[model samples]
Target: MDPAGGCPHAVNARLRTRGAVAPVVLPGEVEGAVVLGHEALKDFLAHPDVAKDPRHFTALHEGRIAEGWPLRTFATVRGMTTADGADHRRLRSLVSRAFTTRRVAELRPDVEALTDRLLDGLEGAAAAGRGVADLRRHFAMPLPMGVIGELLGVDAEYRDRLHHLSSRVVATDLGPEEVLAANRELPALLGTIAAAKAAHPGDDLIGALIAAREEDGDRLAPEELIGTLVLMIVAGHETTLNLITNAVRALCAHRDQLALVRDGRAGWADVVEETLRWDAPVSYFPFRYPVRDLTVGGAVVRRGTPVLAGYSAAGRDPAAHGPDADRFDVTRSARPEAARHLSLGHGAHYCLGAPLARLEATVALERLFARFPELDIAVPEHALAPHAGFVGNSVRDLPVRLHP
Candidate 1:
């Protein structure tokens, strides 16, 4: 947990305890260190020259290569979010059309229906003398998985396997050999799904992607197709899962806010937005390296220095969010204001599933609170297990008692 130890993203706990923004400096006495905050970090993310390709950082690349991780395969290159220039534009445009606000709006009915069904299952379990249930397993995890799986045409039977594959792919602390093993295994599994979709066309994202590939004739590469599918599944499930669990926990801790949500005085949508700001599901974007030498907050970031934008820190920036930035205010009117938080990221690589994530969270919260108005945490917050070095900060299990 030492700030100066392994992860550069780790801030000094002592500095945080002092109630101030932690400064991130370059090694040695650099003239200007990156002063990360809402405004400064926003400028950094908005800067056209602050790129995302990891190849910009030769040292990081060499380190990974020395560790036996694949440098140019699905681990890095094939992923659409990592691409730049014409490639990034082309892929993003194609994918954006599918995730348009209109398209996501159409999926809202299905999201609500799925939420209702999950709530029914939870109610049944509660009635059967199972006084408490892990909301993480019963609701948070499955709701997003089902929605995303339907979008991608992944079979219900294989959804569990896909979830397992996603966990392996995004693991940060895994050794080089372990990461490589995941890289090898993911494609084979996805290849099977791709072949199935190719043989049997269906009304799903994967089918649409396959059709697009066929019509375009080499425009959409096989690796790109599979990687996009994997990204959608992983991105869709992991973030929203945490959003639901975190929102529920936040509500439990604040009974007044829960009452507001239950009585419809405050919309559940506000709760969802506030929860995202309070404790974001995806704490940081994957490592982004500068393509050219750049200055952020007066710090000279050489071309090829790795930078991880701190979304968690940015969410709590006092200037952007006011002095009470740490307070979770569901009634806060500025929730939708632009530059609120980098949870969905900024610029071209911004999350493609933002609309769907919002829809799922809204629907999940509406149904959950309506069903169990007296829901309470089964264990103290500190007792819960935390997911470590993962894309989302998820509770390993969220046990809650549902009072009928």
Candidate 2:
């Protein structure tokens, strides 16, 4: 994995030289295999023998994976992301009851309003500065963060802390002690919020989760409640934040592609799908374990070794998306194979927040361009620093001159 995460495609191209499923080093010097081939990823993502439960991981079970290992937080969490089969079904079912289709649909007006409000903030910032503002800070970051915060019923005072801790969760550069401290602080903070919600329950998702837990503690344990909230609050906004930021960056870099949407040759949906493929929001998802020896992309993955889904690499696989796979063409999503990019994931463990993410990104991009049709990158595209982490793929900051 690229520690800088700036040139994941370059890293993937080099890794593909070894094989689709190549051995790699994880954050804690853990040996892992990443499935980089497009078809191989699609197959293994839904493979019956592959599982996500950390219990399947031999290193963790053998006490090799330390408690302070940065990625431990993800695998050890007792949420749908880390569960399998029956347990996964039960946890997902409980969460689905709260995060329903109606709840997501109900957020459209709020998302639109938030988008406009953020755009207004961007205009203000650009006016105060030299006609330049960070789109990531003013627009891309806040839009989804606000929506997810609202959906989860996170209080305003706790949101900054929530965002800070969640960002730490994906950071691969943290030392063991820092990792340990953050791990403790995050759950403690969330527990405080959970206690508050329990005292004054409402129609929000957290209240609904609390109600579910109160109804049957066995169905949704206290740990599982915190884990689920962690998953929702973190995964919800971070992915969408990068998606919107990446989309804006891609469109600005390739005005021809943006013109396709503006000229009706393609739609914003096409841009979203193409951006997802060409530059995935997630570079690598953590830790899937094979139940037994499995041949993935011609490499035999032994049972219990961590397997990472190389979403960034798989998206641009030439075998899957043709010779010009690296190109950022909005028109590419029209192709049948292009529509199958695993940006949102696959199989039973597919991202539960996919609809909300797509909705947020779509609304955000559409409204942002409508508000500032003349928006362009303030600096050269290559100068934009990549977000520091192997898991999340995005620019650290998107400097743009919003010509509103």
Candidate 3:
């Protein structure tokens, strides 16, 4: 069946036209390839043969490390992103308790309060000038930093520095020397935070991790602790920042849906979900290598083959999402089974912070609309600055007019 041209496919076509290469899909599939590389993408994500080590993908590895960014230390082994099997389980187990539904719900009040504060700052900025502001700077960027900073025990004073370090590290265009610098310096920074959390334990995630390390004994190494903390701070902030920006951009592009959300006729949560599906912040995850030879979709995947799963492509598959899959309709009730948008990922490597991400987006969107009832784009949509590369995609700046 032919797609009516919406969401993922529409975006995928743009990417393809811009020189992004993907596997060729068969006739029946909506995308170029249903079984990208060797097997179905979902199967590859579930396969134990497929490992998350970026080292297997030589080009990506060299490209990221070529730069001397200090945050690379955390990226190389920090958190659950690189871990597989028992190590993945151990790291996930340690932090799993902190991201529970109850915890996310408990944090809603704080999220709302933080959202309000951010809007207050944006309002002040806009009022002082032309009643216009860059949503990325004033709203999207800082909200996640504030929320995740408090969550990870990063000192309030150092949030800006951490944000700078994180941005440089994950930046796709960085050279090897720049990436290496970030990889090296991140540990010392995180080490200082770990010490502070150790000395004066707080009710934050870092403090909890330190306690867990001390009580468990050998459960988590010092490097692992630094890595996990870095992961939480960096990943938590960058991804959420993009998610907020993408959501706003999508709503603005679809005026009717934006009006629906603004008028309170549609559920904000559903709108957020659709936004994630429509223009996900993290477009594609890095390749996972196979530990052994495997056959997928009649193709042979040799050992150590790198497989890149297309989240952007999968979410927009017309076969899975119906003809209007690409349309941003807040009233559209997404099926749980069909909602398997690769945005949060799949299988064992699924995102640990999904619940928290949803909570933040829901709170942020509701507060944003409620505050700036007359918010609209200040610049032409095509003029928006977008961060390019395979790791993450987001608007660099979102200039918008806010009417009180």
Clash statistics: count for each candidate:
0, 0, 36
Give the candidate order by descending lDDT.
2, 1, 3
lDDT of 1 by residue, 1-404 (tens): 22122222244223344233233333222121233466766777677886656566556555533434322232264667677777777676656776889999998888888889998888776666478888888888899999888888889998888877677666555556876787777788888988999899998878888777433465678888877777787888988988999899889998888887667778888898888877778654445666777766555677765565556666766667878877778877544653467767777777888988998998898888777878888889879876645345656789889983
- Candidate 3: segments with Cα more than 4 A from true spot: 1-11, 14-39, 53-75, 214-216, 262-265, 297-299, 334-337
Q: Arrange candidates by TM-score, highest first: which order?
A: 2, 1, 3
- Maximum-TM-score candidate: 2
Ten residues in sequence with the least summed lDDT for candidate 3: 25-34
Q: What is the TM-score of each predicted model, taking all chains together?
A: 0.87, 0.96, 0.85
- Cα lDDT listed for each candidate: 0.70, 0.86, 0.70
Alpha carbon deviation, residue 273, candidate 1 (Å): 1.0
Displacement of the residue 28 alpha carbon in candidate 1, Å: 20
State, as a TM-score between 0 and 1, how close model 2 is to the true structure.
Answer: 0.96
Off by over 4 Å in 2: 2-4, 98-102, 213-217, 336-339
- In TM-score terms, candidate 1 sits at 0.87
Instruction: Give RMSD (Å) of candidate 2 vs. truth.
Output: 1.7
> Per-residue lDDT for 171 in model 3?
59
Better of 2 and 3 by TM-score: 2
